[model samples]
Each structure stands twice: as C-alpha cells, then as structure tokens.
Target: MTMESATDAAPLRTQTVAVKSSFYLAMRILEPARRDAMYAIYAFCRAVDDIADDEGDRAQRREALDQWRYDLDELYAGRIRPRSAFLAGPVRRFGLDRADFEAIIDGMAMDVEEDICAPDWEKLELYCDRVASAVGRLSVRAFGLVDDGAKELPTAPKLLAYHLGRALQLTNILRDLDEDAARGRLYLPREALEEAGVSNHAPHAVLANPALDQVCAPVMSRAREHFEQADLVMAGLSKNAVKAPYLMAAGYRSILDGLTARGFAPPRAPVRMSRRKLVGALLRHAFL
Candidate 1:
C-alpha cells in the first residue's frame, strides 16, 4: 500500500541515470545531492507510467497506482518502504507536495479507462496538468526554482513548470498522434478532429485523412504558445534553477520543431532528434 521515499532507502542514483532520457541527462546539471534525490522521483514516475502504458490488465495497473498513492500517503506519515526510502528525502527537504503526486496517478488512471477518447480541449489540458505539470511542479521544487531571494511570489516556479509541462505534453500529443491512435488512445480534442472533417476516431483513419494537418494545426499552435509562456516565467527565475529545466525544455522543443518540419508526420517513424542533437543542446545550455 505504501511506496518508500528516498530517505527510506538508499537513493537509486544508478537507476535514475540509467533511463537515458533528456531529462535524465539534464538532471546532472543539478548539484549532486539534489540530482540523487530527483532520481527517486523520476524512478517513481517511470514505474507508474510504465504500469499504465505497458500493463495489459487495466485493473492490475489501477491497483498498482493505487498502491503507490497509499505508499505516498504512508511516506508522509513517517513509515517507509525500504525501496522508496529515497523519496522521503525529497518530500521533506524540497516540500514535494502530495496533491501533485495524486494528480499524476489520476492522469495515469485516465489512460487505463476503457474510453481513452479525447474529450474537449479543457479536459485534455487538465490531463496535461495532471500527468505533466504535476511532475514539473515537483521537479522545479527539487531544483530550488521557487525562490530567488523571495523577490517573486512562490508561484513563479509553478508557473514555469505548468507552461513548460503543457508545451511538452502538447508536443508529445502531436508527435505520438499516429501511435497513440493505433493504441486507441487519442489525446487530441475530438472537436479539433471533427473540425478538421474527420468523423471517425480510428488511428489509421485519422492519419490517412487529408485533414490531419488541419486538425493538428491548433494543437501545434497551442504548444508554441505554451512554450512562449514558459519562456516568460523562465526569464523571471534565477539562472541556477532554470538551467536544468531550460535544457530539458530545449530537448523536448526540438521534438516539436522536428514534427513541424516533417509536417507533423504520421506514426510511420516518430519525429525524434538525434542523440547528438539532444546531447549538443545539453552541453550548450547546461552551463548557460
């Protein structure tokens, strides 16, 4: 029922760095202690996400996520899972919020539902808030982005996190449209698809539809807008805390740019930047 925190177990530094994601690399920009603690959160997220996406049985996945919630709650109560003991370090030290984690589980729960249909725009945004922004909020806090001599309100990091998270999630939706559709998971708004002249929700049909580009236009536009908003907040934050997020965003933004360059190409091949490009961005921005 309970997941362990970092304090409850030895920090899984190796496991965190093993994932080989842009975010994984960017995490290195943090000081050693914060980076280690972040691994716990990242590992937790990776586990839960895999459960929702990879588990064939929805009920089983739900049970696992629920167990994570219970673990998180138990963590707050001072009990610990030897495996998750590492999480407690960040939860207590960084003030990682409980609500955010719950929201993330709720988002994953959405994917497990029989109807993974894309609802209205508002609902889709809410989904992004849960799955992406919630994690962002926790990440920003871990990097100590919330305070710059208290010059700005505490909400600054959250604003940065939310916008960047939305931008990333929207870009992900665009990039994975064909794949997600094939999996019976369309994150795009039904309204957008309908407006684009597509009536059926089939992934292949959506990809083959001439109106695919049209339906995707608004999603693309919104992603760009969110990126800009993230930039605005990032501008207000101090350089130290912003570096990790900036580098991470750059990596993700490149995917959006790649998708745009390819005309938001279908699932045939995903629109991904090369490792060299991502690593180059990391080296270029990690210090700046």
Candidate 2:
C-alpha cells in the first residue's frame, strides 16, 4: 500500500500521537512507506503503554491489555478492528512478526502485575528485552532493514535491535529514577543496589540513599557499552538504512550525557535536550 493511503487509513488519534512524540523527526526522515509503518507501530506501543500506566484497577487494566492481544490475534488471522486497521498494511507489507507484538503486550502485563521494586538482574534484562527490544524488532522491520522473504532477521540489524534497545531503555531507567520512584517502581537491578550498599529495596528509600549514584554508575556504563556496540553495528551499514537508529541513538546519547553531568543527587535538576542540541543531532544524523 502507498504511504499516503496507509497513513490516511490510520486512526486519526494514532497519527496525532505519533506526530507529537519526541522521535517524530527521526521517523519523519524515513521514506514515506517506512515512516507510515513506523507511525502505526508507535501507535500500537503507545496504546498498550497507556493501558499499563492507567490508574485504574489492575484486573481491568489486564483485561484491556488482553483485549489488545485478542485484537492482534484477529489481525493476524486476516481480521482487523477499526482502531487497529492501520496495522494491517504494515503487518502484511513488512512481514512484521506476531511474536514481537505479543512480546510488547507481555511487557505491559509485567508492569500491571505489580509495581516492580528492585528486581534481580535477570528479571530486569527480561523486562528490557520484552518492552524495548521487542519494539526495536518491529521497528527494524518497518525501517526496511529486514530482508523480504527472509525467515529471520539479519545478524547486524538483530544485534542493532538488541544493543540499541537495551541502551535506550537503560538510559530511560536511569533518567527516570526519581519519576519511577514516585510511581512506586524502581528498575535498578538488585545486584547493583546490593553492591552499592543500598540495603533498602523500597523505591523511595533507595532513591533517597546517597548510594543511588553509585548504583546508577554501572547501569550508565552498561548503557554506554550498548550504545557503542550499536554504533559499531551501524557503522557497517549504509547511512540511509540506519538513519533513524542513528538519530535515535544520538538523541538518547545526548540525554545520557546530560544525565551523567547532572548526577543522581537529590534536588536533581531535570536533564533535557536543548533545542540547539536537538537541532544539531537532527542535522547530523538525519540530514547530513
């Protein structure tokens, strides 16, 4: 299907939300069909995420997520709901994996099951894979990095999804430490917390601990390593093929740098990308 047709057929709400997202520009730089496909995927993700983050009863939220899973099954079975019809074109055109979509829903279920406290390293990795890497898997397909008729993803793009997904997610976990704590969640791995002398696993208590920065250091280092690995993988690909990933990496790396400079001390100043820096990244990664 043509980009214009696909985009116009998309739910208006999805279009609006995708346009408003921070990654809009990065997505916009893509060829039309890919860009529209990405918008659809982003919309799907945002809808599930909203359900997970809703302040309603947990059972109701889980039910809502289940509804999405049902919708996805129907979608794959050649049925499409009005709200999700946007995905039909992309799913068929890009050969988007059903498992990746299901993984995203599973990740949302994790959030809804309970407020995650200090989870073990394994659980944390699983969460990152489901929530972030799964999305990246879908996105890489949308980005046209996956080969047509290929049964599996190419090694480089798959690795790109793995490393970049974890990098972006870990950066998010570090940047949102205080915000997540407010919501009674803490994503820092228990191993890191224990190693840093943060005996209290309570969200707010851990955030208040002076050792919080100590815990964040290893996570930050891991993020940097992932970013570096993603960079190395992207380095071998054509720039056009990896433009969106490059832009995303640059933007998040900027945020990581800002977080590093700001530190995790209490009364923490918000770390945000300045307009100038954002523009620079856009020019460098998207237009250059």
Candidate 3:
C-alpha cells in the first residue's frame, strides 16, 4: 500500500469515535486522518494516565500500570491480540508502529513510579518527553511523514512534539497548581522559583502570597519558552495535523494569558473554553 493509503485508512475514523467522548469531541476538530492516529495514541495514553491520576489504592495503580506495560509488549509483539474495544481497533487496523505506543507506556510507567511532581527541570523534561512527546511522535507517523526508505522520520517531529507536550504540561501546572500541591505534589521547580526570589513553600501560597507574580515570573518564562517552541513545531506540520494542536495551543495560551491577567493566581476557577470558541475552532478546521 502507498504511504498515504496506509495512513489514511478509514479505521482511524472509527477508532476516533470509539475513544473517550470528551477526547473524541476535542479531536473531531482535526482532519479525519489526523484525528484517527491521535485518538488511538490518546486512548492508550489516557488509560495509562488514568492509572496514575485515578483515586484508588496505590498498589492497585501500580499493578494496573504493570499490566498495561505487559499488554503493550504483547500488542507490539502480536503475541496476544487486543480485542477491538475502545480505541484498540484503529491501532491494529492502521498498523501504527509499536515504538510510539511503547514510548507512551514507558512515560506512564515513569509517572507511576514516583510523585507526579519531580524535583528538577531535567526530571520534568524527562516526564514531558515520555508522556506528551511520545504522543506527538505517534502523530507524526499518522501524518504520513516518512524517511527516504519509507520508515517513519523521528528526530524533528520528536523535538517538536516534546516542546508542545511541555507547553501543555506547564499549562496544566499553572491551572492545577493548587490542587496538585494539596495532593502533596508540586510541579513548579523549587530551584527556578528560588532563583527568581519568590517563595512557594505552601499549598495556598500561590493564591495567598503577595509576591505570587514574582514567584511565578520564572515559571511563566519557562512556559513561554515551551510555547514558542510549540509554535515552531506547528509551522512544520502538515495542514491537517496543525488544526488540532493549534486549537489545543489556543486554549493553553489563554490559560497563560489568564494567569498573567489574574496576577498569576493559582486557578481559583475551572479552566475552560466556551462553546463559541469551540465552534470557532471547528469552523476553522473545516473551512481553513
């Protein structure tokens, strides 16, 4: 089969529909071909992430992640077939490369091994690479970008995906800082804030401290860097793939802007996009 044919299989659309309703709704803004691969990757990623984020026995989460990894190994090896449930069918029907799927599993497993918040920037990047970047790389595969020999091209897309993931994660941090800290997780790097001469020692400090903006200046700067990096990557992708990420970026950028406008307060309100905004994104994807 031709490269385009392989990437554009109709099964991808069916898989997109089978994913979690919210994700499927968000991804529907993407072109059908792009949406398909995105759905399959997201379905797997969501499953792994749920294991980490879900409220349950810690031992149960660890056990579930272990089983997930094992299932991933089996799926890649074609040892035991995955039943056509949720988003599994698209991955099989599209012949998505196993490497991207494994990377996602690797990233989720990393999250399960420790706290959601890491102590350093290096660890944060590692986390972003595994969780978010891995999905982006899989997206590149679905977009039909391949090497000279028809194998998937990896490096450029990998870097691009990594930054986009970082930007999204940073947005998550800003939006959920309070909630995460309450759970004994602080995603903000202590070193970075100290270097900026701002304190964030307590769960409510982000909302309580008068110097909140000062403390967040450095963190926002870092988020801006990742945001810029994501913009560069957006320019590099095909038109079809760009729309979904662009919409995703718009929402994130709004959070950053909203944080600045609110004096960098940790989210006191739910972060959301209005229906009008969602519709605008849908129209843009359809017409532009």
Best-fitting candidate, scored by TM-score: 2
Candidate 3 lDDT by residue in tens digits, 121-214: 7777776676776676666555544332234556666666777777777777777777776665667776666765555555555456666666
Query: Candidate 2 overall Cα lDDT vs. reference?
Result: 0.87
Instruction: Report the error of model 1 at residue 259, Å.
Output: 0.4
Worst 10 residues of 3 by lDDT: 1-10
Off by over 4 Å in 2: 1-7, 286-288
Q: Could you tell me every candidate's TM-score relative to the true structure?
A: 0.89, 0.94, 0.78
Total backbone clashes of model 2?
A: 0
In model 1, what is the error at residue 110, expressed in angstroms? Answer: 0.8
Q: 120-140, model 2: which lDDT tens digit per residue?
A: 989999999999999999889
| Model 1 misplacement above 4 A | 1-9, 13-18, 147-153, 265-267, 274-288
Best by lDDT: 2
lDDT agreement with native, every candidate: 0.76, 0.87, 0.63
Candidates ranked by lDDT, best first? 2, 1, 3
TM-score, prediction 3: 0.78
On the 0 to 100 scale, the lDDT of residue 3 in model 3 is 24
